[model samples]
Target: MKNFSEIEAMARMHHPDLDARLAAHGHLRTAQEIADIPDDRWLSTMTRCVFQAGFVWKVIEAKWPGFEAAFDGFDPVTVSFYSDDDVARLASDERIVRNGQKILATVHNAGFVADISREHGGFGRFMADWPASDQAGLLELLKKRGSRLSGMTAQYFLRFSGWDAWILSKDVGAALVREGVVDKPPTSKAAIARAQAAITAWSDESGRSQSEISRILALSTG
Candidate 1:
């Protein structure tokens, strides 16, 4: 793969204001900041990402207050114990999206978050302790343990929750292919590993966060 500077130059060619755009995109939290985030917020973000999947994000955003109310502020300890009755009630509740499966996913993910919080003292601590270099491993863990947290959903959850992460957007995937990191958008385990390695190497060389590298890759493609 080419050096990250070369990739950045290509991005600048496409968008001359790449740096300013990147500065406004989003900020990565410090480990301390991440460790201080409450478990409820983690659960809330996770549920939002789950619900946003294959659905209209603007609608979700507009009705988010109802979602917050309906899910009991996404307190992991409370939502983790939601029963079948609770599921039925949420499904019938017009305040939220009312998707039964997604509601169920919220319940499952609450337990997932609560369990981690118990084990690690706090879910934020668990996330803070996870090394950024192994984001693929982190994503795999989310896929296996958290409900509806596979693929881009999991990536967005991590990103939105202030975890240092890279999203595999279409443009980023295209740029990866251009760099010969993978022959296609990385779906298979092997392909994803290759892409991760390429990004990790670029990060080491460029001293840029993975999210920034991801954005640069997307910009470079256009």
Candidate 2:
């Protein structure tokens, strides 16, 4: 693969405003900041990502307050204990999207968050402590343990929750293919590992966060 600087130059050539666009997204949080995020908010963010999957994001955003209310502020301890009766109530509730599977996912993910919080003292701490170099491993953990948190959904949850994450968007995947990192979008274990190693190496060379590198790669493709 080419050096990150070369990739960045290619991005700049494609979009002179690349840096501006990236800056508008705001700075990533420090490890301490990430660690300080409350467990409830983590659950809330995860729920939002799950619900937004295969659905229009604007609709989800517009009704987010209803979601917050429906789930009682998404307190993991509370939502984890939601009963079947509660699920039925939410399924017919007009306040939110009322997708039964997504609602159940929220309940299960609350348990997932609560469990992790118990294990590590806080879910935020667990996220902060995870090494960015092994993001694939973290993704695997989410896929296996968390409900509806696989592939792009998991990646977006990490990004939206302020974890230093790289999203393997189509453009980024195409860039990776151009760099000979993989012949296609990485889905299998070995392919993903190879992609991860490439990004980790680029991070080491460029001193940029994986999220930033991911955006640059996407911009380079256009």
Candidate 3:
């Protein structure tokens, strides 16, 4: 396995300029900072990632107020029960992005939020209880339970919601292969497990957040 210092050095070599070294790094939100976020925020972030998956993120961000108003602040209980009429209405709503599939995903994801809330007393509780080392498991739940939240969408949801997530970006995938962790971007459970194990070990050895480790790895091959 490659060390964090080795990865950082590679990034530095790529950047070259002395000041560029510090400019190339990133950080993660601590669990304590993330644990107390409102349940609605979690749903909102998930929905945003869903919408932004194959679309322009800035367009979504610019229209987010419309999205908030259109979705009733993304209240899980309220959204989970959205009627057929509601779906039809949102399909034409000019205020928010009008992608039918993504709009419908909001309703489906609302049910997902409600289920987690019931299981954990609230989605925030689930976030607090979930261990970062087991993020691979959390990814599984997001894919199976959350609507449209598979692959990078699931990862971006966690990352945007302040989890110290490891993104399997193309560059990060290359770094993984270089480090002998995996031969390709992980798709199956076993592949993801191998990726997770290597990341967890790197996190422990480097004392870095998964986000930082992910960035370092991605940057290593850039």
Candidate 4:
């Protein structure tokens, strides 16, 4: 519990003043607060989040040793070739998330990744092709990939990977309110200054990716 609390606090500290805006609108959110991480880390983190859909980060972080070992450090070329036998093996691997469905999706997504690479050069290139400034196209991609993971819930995971920009609605919003980043009673003032202060402080110390930040925040609230 203590460790979880610390992780959550770390997340709160990483926000770029966006939380108050979300809160004012009755939403929960995570945003692009990391400006120093390399592009490759962003790609790999996306693949990792796909693999970790329903699992805890501590579990994934601990098992990351084996995940890196098994998946060739999440090399898209290597993971894209994962076969049915590979899927079965991963389903039983105790060191990883081990969920059958998620394991299969990870492998499947790898194939899609390979296609994206072949047609566009690489995942990063594909990302560039995405119209970040266009909401409908972005949401379409989100919904398409999101179909595999219980409606748009998977969209949040994608957002963590930096593939999309999104805000959390419903329960996650309630969770944020409980975290004390915002007052539940509501007001007109923006808390962006406080939230950005927290995020800047947290970002300077941790090398973890955006999704990791979100997990840390959720764990803090949990």
lDDT of each: 0.94, 0.94, 0.85, 0.51
- Candidates in order, TM-scores: namely 0.99, 0.99, 0.93, 0.52
Off by over 4 Å in 3: 16-27
* 1-222 per-residue lDDT for model 4 (tens digits): 123336555546664443463344322222322333333454356556666665676777777778777666666656668888888888787777777776666665666556666786565565656543342344456446532543234455446555433333443344445556555421212442233233334444564432343344543443
User: For model 1, what is the alpha-carbon lDDT of residue 155?
Assistant: 93
Please give, for residues 182-221, the per-residue lDDT of candidate 3 as tens digits.
8877788998899999899889997877877787787778
How far is 53's C-alpha from truth in model 2 (Å)? Answer: 0.6
**lDDT measured at residue 71 in model 2 versus the true structure, 0 to 100:** 94
Candidate 1 per-residue lDDT, tens place, 1-222, comes to 898999999999989999899999778999999999999999999999999999999999999999999999999999999999999999999999999999999999999999999999999999999998999999999999999999999999999987879999999999999999999999887888888899999999999999898999999998
Locate the minimum summed-lDDT window of 10 residues in model 3.
18-27
